[model samples]
Target: MKTKLNVGCGTDIKPDYINLDVADLPGVDVAHDLTKFPWPFADNSFDTIELINVLEHLPDTIATLEELHRIARPDAKVMVRVPYWNSPDMLADPTHLRSFSERTLNFFDPAFPECKDRPYYSTARFNIMRKSCYIRFFYYLKINARFLTTPLFFLARYLGAVVWVIEFDLRAAKSDNK
Candidate 1:
């Protein structure tokens, strides 16, 4: 059976997923602190995992990503959503420890320039598959969200605050160690 994990799934539980959160909510299947290292699951335990609007709340982004990578099966797909770096929504919540942009996840991509030299930065490797952006004021208008992250990703470099949230689909790289 394929195992799927919904990390930081507060109250939104999916019957198909093992819901996890720090709070002992009714839907949480595993109420464990996310900040702590070595999640309860064994290595390469999950084939699919998601962190919807959860990355920003964690204190250590890289560490959490690494742990997620450790528990994921080879080439497992991981989805993450976080408040856009320039958006006020990131600062609106006191629990938000950090904000992210279209390029923020690139730090975990071993092929990305930022991580090429810093081998010690993070051991986790992910190949970014797709990225999308959400604009709050224009929520009703579905103005080509893909462009915000494609060749026109440069737009965020200048007018990033306009973006409310950024979502990424990543495929975990195969690891020999695992």
Candidate 2:
């Protein structure tokens, strides 16, 4: 069977996924705080990971990403959804520990100029195969509720919601030791 993990999966549980969260819930496969190291899963065990509205809540983004890298299969695809820094949703959440901008995830992009000297840089160590965004549907509908039933809604999704999706891949670094 394909192994899929939903990290920080609060109430939204995907049927096929191993729903993980710090809190106790009915279908939770794992209930451990993310702040600690060494997640329950074995190294390179998961094919896909979903972090929906979760990254900003982690106290240490670098450590969290490192753990994510440790658990994922060599060429895993990770989907992350976070509120844009400027959006009200970002600030409204009292538990949100970090704010994200366009460059937030790019820190993992190898081509980024400052990857060499930065201590927190991980993209240089992992290959980023993809990156994209999507605007929240509710946000679009709020801006133009009148256009809700029109094709413009679809156009907005195709054209305007580019900053939202934030999808990417992280390839494990080739080790010289091997």
Deviating ranges (above 4 Å) for candidate 2: 117-124, 136-178
- Candidate 1: lDDT of 113? 84
Which number leads on lDDT? 1
TM-scores for candidates 1 onward, in order: 0.90, 0.75
lDDT of each: 0.84, 0.67
**lDDT at 29, model 2:** 81
Could you give candidate 1's per-residue lDDT for residues 29-69 as a string of tens digits?
99999999888999998989999999999989999999999
Which residue pairs collide in model 1, if any?
Answer: none
Please write out the lDDT profile of model 2 over residues 11-97, one tens digit for every residue.
Answer: 898899999999989888889998988888887777788888889899988888888877777666676666656556666789989
Clashes within 3 Å, all models in order:
0, 7
**Cα TM-score of candidate 1:** 0.90
